[model samples]
Target: MAGKRVAGGGGREEDGSKVGLPAMDLALAFPQATPASIFPHSVSDYYQFDDLLTTEERSIRKKVRSIMEKEIAPIMAEYWEKAEFPFNAIPKLASLGVAGGTIKGYGCPGLSITASAITMAEIARVDASCSTFILVHSSLAMVTIALCGSEAQKQNCLPSLSQLCTVGCWALTEPNYGSDASSLRTTATKVPGGWHIDGQKRWIGNSTFADVLVVLARNADTKQLNGFIVRKGAPGLKATKIENKIGLRMVQNGDIVFNKVFVPEEDRLPGVNSFQDISKVLAISRIMVAWQPIGISMGVFDMCHRYLKERKQFGVPLAAFQLNQEKLVRMLGNIQSMLLVGWRLCKLYESGKMTPGHASLGKAWTSRTAREVVSLGRELLGGNGILADFLVAKAFCDLEPIYSYEGTYDINSLVTGREITGVASFKPAALARARL
Candidate 1:
């Protein structure tokens, strides 16, 4: 048989041939079997974990999957090509009742954390930008309201948000503050009738066309970070669409400028007063970020699996090579381990036992693993990997933000290390002062 010799590990003799041979026929052949289907057309087999869901949860997952495959997938590549958001899908997505999957009341579904994870995984498998849009809307925007908004705020915001009648963006990252979100320089000063917000926010997702924005600013008087609901078109609120992103081109990222934007007292999140309140929201959102990479890894895995089986070299399928098989198995193992971690983290969140360190660990581990998986997938595709038609190239680009956002791998590692060691290691040793 003609095939390229793939060298790896110890050699095993077959049919009187030594290991590492170009090809060998096994003496003990069971039978020649037909090739199994590569991947399910419906993606049901891809998400067999649905059996773990409750009846209601399962129904919602199926419905969301249907919407994604039918509505989102067909148009995703086009939008990705043009680097634009599909605002048209909002109405259909809203009709699915998934925007507030795990939140209670005000027209939210109040489902379990598992359901939320499943929804994110399904949407992301088809289109990551679409998944990000929901993740920001449901987890960041709606979860902030659930965790830190007043009853009146929830009642007013949650309904429109659940129905997708209104879109929301969370603005915490400033023009200068990416990793040091707490040190944000945006200022809010109290006026007679309301507060004046002045500052610029960068890399704000969904803000380019969002109906409302949850803005975080430091109070000029108290010097405490505060959250406010700044409606779209508010005076002095300017959102400029950010262009030319190498990844996530389908999602609209924006740079927002709040120049003396006046917001009423009622618009301020009453429960938010200090950075601690903001920490609460970040804690939950970080865990949500963890799942994005898991989904991306799975997408890469599926693509690689299919390509390996279909693409041939030396007149033999690429999957026939032992080295290729080893790569596939390694990728699968990493994906499975990451999925288990994500599942357990979601459980901890549902039980109210989750901490900032837990979110940090999940985000750090999965995001790093996702970057590795995508890199490997790109390598497996050879020269074709760099081409946009292969899709792995896009996955490669998208994983960069996943590894950096929420918190970089280094920052999250230090956070988890501090929790385990019971010591703070945020700054350099030269800056550390000994406790008296």
Candidate 2:
């Protein structure tokens, strides 16, 4: 009996129509050592750096990795392409209960410094924008209050922020002053019950929609820098989103305008009195920034390794070539070295023995190495590397902001050099007179 033919794809014939040819073996016949799988599973951790982590630390990494893979990985590329923030994912992220990182109490997670550092690395392993968003919220904004806010302020703010009920941003850099944060232009005039903040902040993360903003303004009376908590919908406070950024596009960086914004005395952070006080925050954050590149570099390496294994040219797999293998090896070496440095930096932080200069050195060295690693990854990918869909292009561009921020490469190096040498290089070059 003749079978009726379907009008679509299938090996069938009806009436006098010819049957479709037998299915051909179209799969590639390349020699392989192991079955191919989509990344993460096949990623090479050449040095077994996970062995150094504690059980809690590894658990945190695994949990965060799962979150990033399930939630962030699906949508990050789209958000990056649109240059928009993912407002919807905040709840799921907050559910992870890592907002406090190393901070104790006030509904905070109270995790160890190393564990917190591991979380940041895990986040960066997927997307730098998401990790930087956390860096701004947890490392900078929440930690500012944890370290310097009054008890009443902490009781009021910390719980909501810890739960992600309220997103916060730390405002310190201004349009005219980035590296020289001490020379800020923002002014806080003393008023009847509080302060009238009149100035602006630039490059503020989470500023556009954050419920709370921690602003740094110089006191008009004492001429000292101070931190003030300003709520959203303040009469004269406006946060305009910065546009056309090439890196970290998913983060909502803003130019915040303060037009006589009044903050109650209770909102003022009493503990932040000087640049020295602010340095406390920077010291820890710089260490975290040092870890960011390590994760980002590992991500780049993972992508390259997978591409090399699957992509073929001249009827040979890319991974089979010697030059391509060297590139991956170099990237892995950079990742391992960066991982060790960041781990040691965390130990120093845990011991309370980490100096700002030591942190500056780590941040400087690791970010520099990551640049090389990402550049090599882009090369290994050839033409496909430029597309955000492949991951390396976005990561390569994202590394720029990370490199320049925290501190410029030369600036961090000079900071380390200043600590090693007794002389300050930033001071005016009076060596011309010393020659006499």
Among the numbered candidates, top lDDT falls to 2
The lDDT per prediction is 0.80, 0.86
Per-residue CA lDDT of model 2 for 1-436, tens digit only, reads 4467555664455554667665442233323211112225426468898899899998988898788777787677789989998889898789667897888999999999889888888788788998998899999999999999999989999999999999999999999998877899899999999999999889999999999899999999899989999999999999999999999999999999999999999999999998788899888788888989988888788888877877889999899999999999999888889989999999998898998789999999999999999999999988777867667899999999999998888889889999999666864588746866
Model 2: C-alpha RMSD to truth? 9.0
Clashing pairs in 2: none
The Cα RMSD in angstroms, rounded to one decimal, for candidate 1 relative to the true structure is: 11.5
lDDT of 1 by residue, 183-278 (tens): 999999999888999999999899989887998999999999888999999999999989988888877889999999999999989888999987
Residue 9's lDDT within candidate 2 is 61
lDDT of 1: 0.80
